[model samples]
Target chain A: MASPARGNHVWVGSETGILKGINLQKKQATNYKFGDAVLSRHEAVTTMCWGDPYESEIYVGCLDGSVKLFSTEKGKFTESRDCREGEGPFCGLAVLDGSLITCVQSGLLKVWRDTSSENVEIQVGPGVCRMCQNPEQLHRVATGGKENCLKVWDLHQPQEPIFRAKNVRNDWLDLRVPIWDRDMQFLPGSEKIVTCTGYHQVRLYDPSSPQRRPVLEATFGEYPLTALSLTPDANAVVVGSSRGDVAVIDLRQGRLVKCLKGFAGSVRAIQCHPALPLVASCGLDRFLRVHNLHQKRLEHKVYLKSRLNCLLLTSREKWENEDSPAELQSDVKEEEDDEIWNSMEVVATKRKAETQPCCESGNKEPRKDKPSRKKKIRKAES
Target chain B: MAEKLGKGRTSQKAQHNAEKAEAVASPGEGQGAPVQPDQVLFPPSFSVSEIKNKQRRHFMFLRWKQQQRKEKLAIKKKRKKEREALGDKAPPKPVPKTIENQRVYDETTVDPNDEEVALDEATDEFAPYFNRQTVPKILITTSDRPRGKTVRFCEQLSKCIPNSHVYYRRGLALKRIIPQCMSRDFTDLIVINEDRKIPNGLVLSHLPDGPTAHFRMSSVRLRKEIKRKGKAPTEHQPEVILNNFTTRLGHSIGRMFASLFPHDPQFVGRQVATFHNQRDYIFFRFHRYIFKNEKKVAIQELGPRFTLKLRSLQKGTFDSKFGEYEWIHKRHEMDTSRRKFHL
Candidate 1:
């Protein structure tokens, strides 16, 4: 179990309470069941997150209000604790500096520390759908749900929200627009928060701005969007809808970029690689699919034999191919050379002479030579 | 072909020489060509429809069909004789290709001995029904203002399953009806939707908790429409036969159909309910059987048969707007291959 779990690229939580580890390089899947009891939906994993930056440990939150800690090194569950503060299944799970943060559907958010007396419990609001931590600022976490607007709380303060999003204006009919933020992510380099709502809208909120409402809003397909993840470049987001439509939406232009196909059910979770152009998604279709973001092509599809609830993609680089690191190093060296060339100045006449044909011939030479060269080669062969 | 068209639109004398010249030169031109050797044996292009005289064309077509049949029979006879002569040394016969036999490989096909699938089935929504913990009490309703044919179809379906009740929809929302059904101890809710006086959709939702299945219902035949159907079904429980439900999704669907009936079947009634799935279409049939002799059995079809194609399977009860779908039939994406089947 330790050997198989070591190189796994993705970890998917299924509705059957089985934690599946998939090694994309080997095309092998290993299932880790916690106990000897009968497999039941009561213990189905509702949410999962890495316990630390190294991703060696996993925190699995189940529907039965138990949070089990799994160590990838040992390939076994190390600890299990009942987070019984909430009334419903866990909506989200996160780890901040070795402490565990869990939020349930009943709006109970609890922070568990090494000492029981230091535990902090906060009620964000009722009907909370998701609670996610800001990666850049470890202490900041956001919570939103049905009828619950986006609220970013500073865990250090715990008294008031640092940033609270106001609801968008009413529709043309003068009725209040609904609020159902199914999933959200914090942009890496900025204070902007991107969220996908159950009403099929993708909204970007800038906490640093004076306005409390979302600055940019874009709607995708008709069905409610269930999950979303930002691309590695952080310029676009991949959103999945309840009707199995997954598309990349450009955050800057608020435009649809490209749609990834071959999904047959509602997408429950999507996690994009932090560096690679790949996105892994799993849903009720019972298949985990990895799509290449650049090519927009499905790369791998594995049938895990149960409805999937959540997904976690490894942030490790060079997992797809071992030889990629050498190529990436050469690319970095070439970029450095290009920077040196750009820094040097040249005489005005020589620069004009060097740049004119380079620009004109670069575009014209290929068109003029390609067909004629092919014809000459054909004639010589004949 | 050109001559035949010209012969209809204008006088026969007009373009008669050109038509004759072309038709006479066409076959000669084919024979003269070096690229097409088969053109010598057959004309370049000729169809019976191009023949001007309808009577003569019909006669020629019939004779051609008969000749083809004769050739096929001759090949069969020759093969059989060769096989008989070399009975001990004949090679194995080649299997014919069929859509089912050449079906695309489905990774989700359940292996009976697989422990995970068995465990999954054991704890699914149908576990109580399969474990005999909950008695099967079905409430069959129709879309509001159901027509006579759909109405009669539901009535006939109720007769086939024991402990099933047919209820009028009475213009109530299914969401509202679900809570009322749960309080009354209903184990299943089946709603038949009709369009243009014909039943076109069927929604089967498991009660209390659900994995609701929506199916496109077609080719519905009532009792009076069936030719030589048996009498109205008896009240005793009938044995259920589910065929070709091989995949994981198919297993769930098969279990849903199986749970609609009681646990113990009454053999004395000799009644059977079969849900036969082929190429993703489920055919429902009720029959009564009797063994006449050791090797011979007679079966009579009961009333009301229909075909169902699964449209979607939702995780919860009757919330299309917000409910998550387990599997959905996307015609453009999923139906790209003819030999591919979901159930």
Candidate 2:
């Protein structure tokens, strides 16, 4: 599928061995299945990102355990089956300087990039997903998974992370933190990450200084905050919640800008315009709302048909100022005709019934197994 | 259910004190509230033996949580700028300690083992229920406590409606003194029990008005009377004997308070065991402290129509124990939550 960001082009890698360029401007885009149609297994798209500058060479992660390279130039994709199956079920894919970092569910992360001699590329791996190149020291990169401590590998000595940051033994830190780290932030233009827990407090940490404690923690919300996004400038963090309340915590002030409330469900995803202060959040409410982080009001709401399991927002503009309340009120009315919101009642009812288990067979097992496991792991490990 | 429940209309409100009920109670006792005919009225009465023993631990835990959160916030504010400048160079500062008093209103456990343990300890000296021999001279109405456990729920008691005066003074030994204040209005001498305002169906404890203590007291008093008279005191020993005395007094004073007397009852609840065969009613879940030692104390709820369900106590327990008296059961039903210490 086309990348959700501002770029007009996308690297579409389909399960049918199809790697193609899909133009958003055109109604009829071209398609080319990289392999014979008969060999396609219709695998799930594991991960995809705008991995290139020109927006070409779409990196497609597939469940079948391989990354496919789709070129917009050829209008077709090629598979790097060189990586064996089960070696990765890469859930995350990010591109830094033409080098690819793939985060697999099995806790293994690999970096693939060209070395000298151009085509003679090095595929370094068997490491965790804590991979990030030191902007100050390009040769020095780090890798860690949620399960393993981070290890920094210099192109010269690619062994372990430079030094272990004595993080609270939380599973998320134990592994490379998630794409949306709810607890804290990683400082801008640096390798520092922040985390928060218990009453929605934020804590900042710089792994470079592992033994030292965090720098700042801004507390907000009356309950547990479930999601967080950085303002494009990285000065303030837009925190979201287990309840659909959102707030902007200005680090300079060490206080919450506002506690925004509207949605009835816990927030699941948060994204802000790269330049514009507009923030888009979607959650169990199934409604994607765009708000001016400053005005902190519902600007636009796009009703999705699902509970909005996940979303990606890509904007090129930077946020400049706060929004006015009057503008927000009018924008909210425009969403009244939103058909996605029109189906919410029915969707909620359907969801409720499916969630409750009917006594099945003669043997009625305790319904708590899955629910308990999730609760236990979250409370114990996280 | 809403229509069936009548509102509270008390004209005479009193505070509790270190005295027996018969001494403070008029023939028609209460907060001088006229008992509504349709409502089952009663006092907020229960066995203090339950909570004084089994549930203080849980109450203490909640107090600790409140204290921790307060300290954490204060220290954080003081160290904010300094720490941010250090930027991970220095360790995070610890939470400060500024918060003071916290209160608790919930009590879950009231089993025999714990009460027995308490009975063996200090309660035997202070509470009369354990021995079922001593007539308790003091009735302590409390909401909850925190100021280092040095005071009763006096803070909460002050908030008790019918806006009353409250008191608090540690004893000579620096022991906790449940504050009781004197007043001239409806809340006069009223020390409100703050526990009533709690959010949940509060598992509250009070001085048990059970027949066990009454039975033992009555039996012992009557036994001595028969021995002194050299004849068997009649079947209705205590009731008959006390009635002659209180009846004359109940009516003459009834005339004096004719203008102040209650016409209706304000209470709710049917008979049910809450803590293992312990009978409790919702009506009298709140009580009154009418004119005692110049300091009146009472227990009352904050809202109307609090929903609650019984946990372990059964319906038949009271029946089997006091099977001989139909009036006791009827009165128990009416008495548990009824406000009609009816004239």
Candidate 3:
């Protein structure tokens, strides 16, 4: 586990196009720019996940429309093979049962079970915004997207999705599975799923409950919820809002536990360690904060220079090596040069930077304007 | 007489040898002139044919004596060379302590914040074996000489180990319900356990690392050096016995505690209630635990991030088990318990 110390190891991906790993142990960071090559090769790392159960593996989803698999054991860009095959930028990724599932912007879903097939691709669309699987039965799959659809595929039969739920989402096109409904599995099992949205509310539904609508709908008074996580015990729901704060809702009592303060930007994602009751939240502010649920203390906070789009923490001793934050030996130095180009352009395009990039450009900027204005008015009063 | 003579024979020879050694040494001082080549010369005594033989024999004897002299000189020179080398490289002679560097020992002068935090964190981890700084020991009379002596000893010892508790045989009847309590060690405190169990919660970590826990009162936390399993030398009798005893104790404790928690407890520790010098065990439960090792991470928030690998051994004499990292820590906790053994 990354020790939640002030210097805890963290992976920071810059808009300039480089993913750097931070090593809190050595008080150093090793970073390599996603070269015009690795960036153009596998550009725009929108999501980052630690792969290979032992942690020597790293799966990065690039907006350049490629899911690059890097091996820390081999200590270099293992290979920047285009898993999406120039389909489009990869938005999110999840590693299930030793197989890697990636959601791309072009509405294509691909699975790389192992390092083989540098050019293999699988297409499952709604522009696969997010992906998840039923842990109880690995065959049950859930893929959500821009079309307000949640397609559950049982790989046991790959040609057809076991069941598809339509009109599940109505807002943003990008969707990611931030929580698992382990409670929703059947007869002595559960299937309840709780999902957060760009739509200012969190909804819970049980596919097995045979209900078209959500069983529970949790809404926030202010900005839309960008990220949220349910406590392992399912007693509370922690949501990160567009207005830069993390709120803990006690579901049993149906009241606010406590809201953490001090982030300048919106919260992106929230996750809880299975064995730790603590809540970990990351977002536009690029700070990873861990809160001790019982003690109600934000135990530690690690600041990053760039926005954190997604994060997955599994027990891996070799995780920080994923980017080798401070490794001078990496041949990927060209990545930093590419990042320099992106950040400099972003610097020139502050107006666009203000507009959420994850929401995509042009149309979403106009849409994000109203909420950000409301946030400013509310911040002034609060 | 022969037997007696046999016993004293080496000594008698030694005594005579001493005399001979003395004789050889007395005139060997610098004042005595060293034998030179010219000091002793031989005269020729022989007839023509007979003379050749006699002269040859005499010459041989002279040559032999000269060689003996050379050998003696060489031996003497070698001893002189050895003494000179020893003078240059021999270890410095021990000098009696001058008492200049020795100073009065005082532990209270450290930064209180860091000390408190470190002690709290460590004692929290090794909670069960911790001896706290508060809690005054009220000695009871029936508490035979041993009990009172132990209490007095602990009063001084507990200052060193911050998480430990000693009841000290207070004559008060063992009551099941008692809510009233105060920190009697001249410190401000309050009651924790509403039940009759010990006031201190067994720190799943309140354990000392082996015998190192015994000296914990000095507030120095030490980890026991675990010898690599396969490489440990087994030829020594003491090590073999100690290894077997600790191995069984560890396996038994791990099994017993694993059953108690069924689920990984918030805390970890082994509890020993000593009465009549015998120990009955109890496992400490925790409020929270954070563990990170190789392979699996069983976080409370995520459950088990990876497959939980736990290896356990049932209670059977002479049983030793090497489990996964998860069980290894628990077994470590078990082995940490102070076992009553013949010192």
Candidate 4:
């Protein structure tokens, strides 16, 4: 019987428009290139979403407004489609109920179907920085940005936002507060939405509440917060700033739990493992680092040599029973061959030295050398 | 007896051979000059003044004197070159004057016998207006002509001010923009006018009041100068320095200016912005940081430093004529006059 693949693989999107799959167990990375010259050099992979719950197909959004679907099994791009003209360089992508949903920076959210020419389009707002889908309620998505505060939209309704964030009242100085939400995520099992802003603020908005403003507001470093991810337990969120500072903020207390160091560039994407207490992050620094949440130690680090924009972690259960027995057997045979070859080199050198001086007495020397060659014969047999 | 004699002869011969080998191996050691008894012995103590006199006449002292003379000659040559460059127009000497002895005319220090005082008295009849608030609430806006660069410039300026906001003109008339500003309660308004896709004019107006200043901005460039040499490291954080600000008020003003530009995104690990003020002109220097380590920071100029100058100042609200440009003429006129102004 074959042993299962021991660890999960991380999929990353690079700035050169390449999709990379890194196997943590083998420390091997495989680059999947698009066929037919589809992706240009300047077309960076901006956003990515899995097509199905099984994650067999991945939808990758590019900077040139093209969305390519890649097959995880075949390790190649299966199809490509262009969004409406002047619509993309998508900020977010999601596959819900077999339909493709793409949100552009200009706040055009479009839902496309495979067989129909008709598409549902909604204008969220201009300067939309991020659009995130609620994992619990797949039909609901949130969008926010510069002038466009936070708004949760329902695909079923498609007309207006379900929850629109009202701008906070005038500050203590009676000045209107500016709104700039850079990234947001939905808290699991709740109607609350957590958003990080360019103003260096992390705010949590509960739509179920009567109030329209954020219920909890916390400030981080002076720089803008670029990306954030909820922990598996949903009690805390890991926020990364443009200054490369990453910290876990407690949701209940609105206090910082701990800061994870070692980032030198703006962190682009961060995600925590669903099954294990591990958080994997990638950024402009071109490194994918997996950190243990409990131990606070880096578990694995791989340099992809390209600025990474997005990453997805494969399900850990699928890792089990994934490695084939035939490959493992071949690997063992190759190691044995290497060992035999190394020993053969030493035996050949010894034989040459003995044969050079005994050329005249070669026949007698061969009979005498037979006794001294026992070790070489035994090594070859093994 | 004969056996013992033979062994003794052989040992003596071996010793002589060893001695001969040592002599041949190190001839310089054997031929070294003999040391004098006085040289090996410590010298008698001398007085400190006597030692100093002897040292002053030594070759080391002469070498020091020569180096000093060379430096003095170089300094003299540089001064002579500067003087030659200046020609006949040397900087005027500063005249020392005491506050009590200084004569005042039209609330300005002037010579008692000056003939221009009568003419200046007519200008001093108007009272000065002051906006007392220290912290500024600014609204940054671009001209009706909207371009990508202008919008980006407006966005950068908005980020520089903590309480400021960016609003694109989007072909909206000033009549419509004013009401929106009033509703939003913006204390000040800044409009950047672009000509041929280049920012050439800036209009600063106090909201709900008059007196707008127009400035001419020249030499606008974006990230055109920043060049990425190698792979940007993971830990690079851009450093921001606002230089040449003096007191606490100046520090606050410097901070307000620094807040106009967005936090360095640090995409290439070396983006830096330096705002340096000399006299009334502010020079903006944007560059890429080159750091070998924490202690070594190298600045590679990314683009040409931009210089801003005040072109014109209107007395009252942007287009309306009401107050005189006394604030521009004398910055401390309001503080000294103790007059109240309505906004």
DockQ winner among the candidates? Answer: 1
Candidate 2 residues B7-30, lDDT tens each?
321222221221143232232233
Please list the Cα RMSD from the true structure of every candidate, rounded to 1 decimal place: 10.5, 30.9, 27.6, 25.5
lDDT tens readout by residue for model 3, A126-217: 44556665656755656665544555666656677665553444447566433211111111146656665555556665677676566666
Q: What is the TM-score of each candidate against the true structure?
A: 0.86, 0.34, 0.38, 0.47
Candidate 3 docking category?
incorrect
Candidate with better lDDT, 2 vs 4:
4
Off by over 4 Å in 2: A1-48, A54-91, A113-156, A168-185, A196-201, A208-211, A219-226, A264-268, A307-312, A318-382, B1-343
For residues B30-148, what per-residue lDDT tens digits would candidate 4 score against the true structure?
12433232443222232123335575536444553454466468668867787788988966645887432252222122333543222222222111112222334578888886687
Q: iRMSD (Å) of candidate 3?
A: 22.8
Per-candidate DockQ values are 0.61, 0.01, 0.00, 0.02
lDDT of 2 at B125: 20
lDDT, candidate 4, equals 0.67
List residue ranges in candidate 3 displaced over 4 A: A1-9, A23-29, A32-42, A72-76, A85-88, A113-128, A166-189, A251-255, A316-382, B1-343
Interface RMSD of each: 0.9, 28.2, 22.8, 25.8
Better of 3 and 4 by TM-score: 4
lDDT of 4 by residue, A127-240 (tens): 998999998899899999988899999998999899999988889999999899989999888999999988888999999999999999998877678889888898999998
TM-score of chain B of each: 0.86, 0.16, 0.18, 0.41
lDDT of 1 by residue, A1-382 (tens): 2344656789999999999999887789999989676778899999999987767789999999999998876777888998888798999899988899999999988899999999888889999999999998888999999999999999999988999999999999999999999999999999999999999999999999999999999999888999999999999999999889999999999999999999999999999999989999999999999999999999999999989999999997857432233333332343446555456645434644654555455457569989999999999999
Which ten contiguous residues of candidate 4 chain A have the minimum total lDDT?
A1-10
Comparison by TM-score, 1 against 2, better one: 1
